[model samples]
Target: MSALHFSRVVIVGVGLIGGSLALSLKRAGVVGTVVGVGRSAASLEKAKSLGVIDEIASLEDAARGASLIVLCAPVAQNFALLHALEPHLEPGTIVTDAGSTKSDVIMAAKTALGDKVAQFVPAHPIAGRELSGVEAALNDLYLGKKVVLCPLQENARTDVAAVRAMWESTGADCHVMSAVQHDAVFAAVSHLPHLLAFALVAQLVNAEDAALKLDFAGGGFRDFTRIAGSSPEMWRDICIANKEALLREIDTYEKVLAHLKTQIKEGDAEGLERVFTRASGARQKWGTARAAVTNVEP
Candidate 1:
């Protein structure tokens, strides 16, 4: 298949994900003009100055003759953004997203766009950093990362293929799954971990000896809570969006934690060792397999 190129691509948020996508497409020569639309004027200016975007336009104007529009804002904002864009959205303008959650955004699109819902292809790129904003955006951020596409049944195959090509052009591998599966999988791996990281830091900060503990924090603590530095507003929306799945994961985790606590308190050394050894072996195996298969671009 010939490489698909979008002449004009509009990024609604222009943050790290959006900016990185713009940079990636530019680097790959798959897009002409990168237009940025956002609530923050200063951010748009910064994205422009940094060459992340070629022009700043309103959502209304940005929709005109756009080959592709990507909504990279916080997951919850998708509803409002889609609602606002629906009226101005022109025919043949394909919309996609870089949101972490899929089901909620798909529902939002169905509600807001109605018949135009087919034009929206919900996607999530499994790529990011501890840093955020346009300034932190890197052209290679999506290189070798996974992008999940939960396309609506109403979506044309050509539209789905176009969206896949767009992501593939950024050096990402695209996988197709139902929105329900996408949400459940990410809830376990991504959302729950971020919640735990933030909760750990919250526990430490609220402790009476927080200062002392933090002053002596070692690599273990740092490594465990590293994701706690992620965007609070963004993760807040994600947790809320995928609340049901996340709550289920949290409940399962609590049961495991209780089991471990009991094992420790009861001095069941063998039981603890059994669990730890199994976990360590699984993690190592997964790491080795992933490293062997993944083409991590430098």
Candidate 2:
């Protein structure tokens, strides 16, 4: 397939996702210029030095001239940035985002951009490292990953196509879904998992033998709690933004946990084994299928 090209692309946040997108586009020679806008001049300068951006500009200034604008900031921050970019966004400019949740972002775009919401595509790339910031960005970070695009009712076909093409150029497989569905799915798979990991670590910290227990923790703890080391601010925003769906998932998980607790307390080894065996088999099957479908190297 021929690569999609853009004359100019403005990235509102020069952090991990935004920087990686800029690097990927530049490496593919699919974008002419990438202008970065951020609240931190130091971070912007670092992004420029890393060659993830061609220059730095105010969000309004950058949005005015770009063929595409990508918002990679936290969910809450995107609201203000979207409002600021509304007046400056041209008719042909396609605006998209790399937020974790879609429903909230779609709502923000509607409230902030009004009629210009037609050009806005809410996207979430299902890929990331535990580390963040521009320094951790990689050109191939999104290669073979999944990107979900939740298009608004006002979005034109051409605009949606352009957004898909942009992510495709970054080597992502794009899928389309309704905003409500996207949020619900991600809340169960991504948001709730992160919350669980964070909660596990918090529980450990509150334990009387916290320090000694952590000191003796093995690979199991490390593997399970890895995401607990993720950006607190970003996860905080996502959890709150998708609180409704996340709460539902949490409730479901709690019921399952209570069932397991009851089995253990009653010394029902058969029941415990049945539950563990079922979960273990399902996890193994999912791992194999996900690897096959995504072609992601382990």
Candidate 3:
């Protein structure tokens, strides 16, 4: 079985992730033709000009002869997009997504693709930059990153393997799991952190001395809130799509914070120190483990 090559790949959203995927695929010589389909003509044009796509076409037109299709749009819109794309997709065209949420996407695919659900693979590439758009696309964006695939029950072994191979060609380590498990893991680690970052920045922005505090903000503040500057619409969709898991994570975090607050209020230095030490140690261990896994010198 061929691993890397696709006769044609149709990328539904030619924004950062989609554009980068297109570029990386082309660079690897895995795709013969890259067709980008998006609502914004300007964005598609930019993607084309930057060589992220060989051409731009309507979803109906691009799906005509594509061997593979990738939905790189927000999770909320992907449901409708899949329905809209169903009639246009040619036989044997394998579909996948670069969405953050998995369960909702799997349900959407099951509903829209129906009998053809086996052709669709739900995937999430756990890598991104703070930037957005075709202009911010990088060919190496997924290199050394993780790409999680939650294959539908209908998916055949070959379909999953093809999609996994595509991600691996971009230097991403591919992992397969159930949609429910993927969502729960990501909700705790990625989604919760993004929400917290956004909340912290919002709190600061709405503060009485907002301008003064922002002006005096240091590296730690900037680092923690960097994700707050991400696409609002995208994050909003992610939060809503994975609301259940995210809420559970938020509740757990709140409980932890409340316990720490009580420690501080009671002047329990020992408790505070214990909590801080545990958290610090855990963070350091995680960082080191992550670096080792990704083979990055630390």
lDDT of each: 0.94, 0.91, 0.90
RMSD in angstroms, all models?
A: 1.7, 1.5, 1.5
Rate residue 2 of model 2 by lDDT: 45
**Residue-wise C-alpha lDDT for candidate 2, range 1-298, written one tens digit per residue:** 2457898899988898999999998887889899999989999999999899998999878877689999999888988998988888898899999999988888889999998888898899988888999999999998988999988778888888998888888899999988889989999989999999999999999999999999999999999999999999999999999989999999999999999999999999999999999999999889889889976542
Q: Judging by TM-score, tell me the better candidate of 1 and 2.
A: 1
Candidate 1: give its CA RMSD in angstroms: 1.7
Which segments of candidate 1 are over 4 A away from where they belong? 295-298
Alpha carbon lDDT of residue 72, candidate 1?
Answer: 96
Tens digits of per-residue lDDT, candidate 1, 257-293, equal 9999999999999999999999999988888888887
lDDT score, residue 296, model 3?
A: 83
- Window of ten residues with lowest summed lDDT in model 1: 289-298
Residue pairs with backbone overlap in model 3: none
| Model 2 pairs whose backbones collide | none
Which run of 10 residues does model 2 get worst, by summed lDDT? 289-298
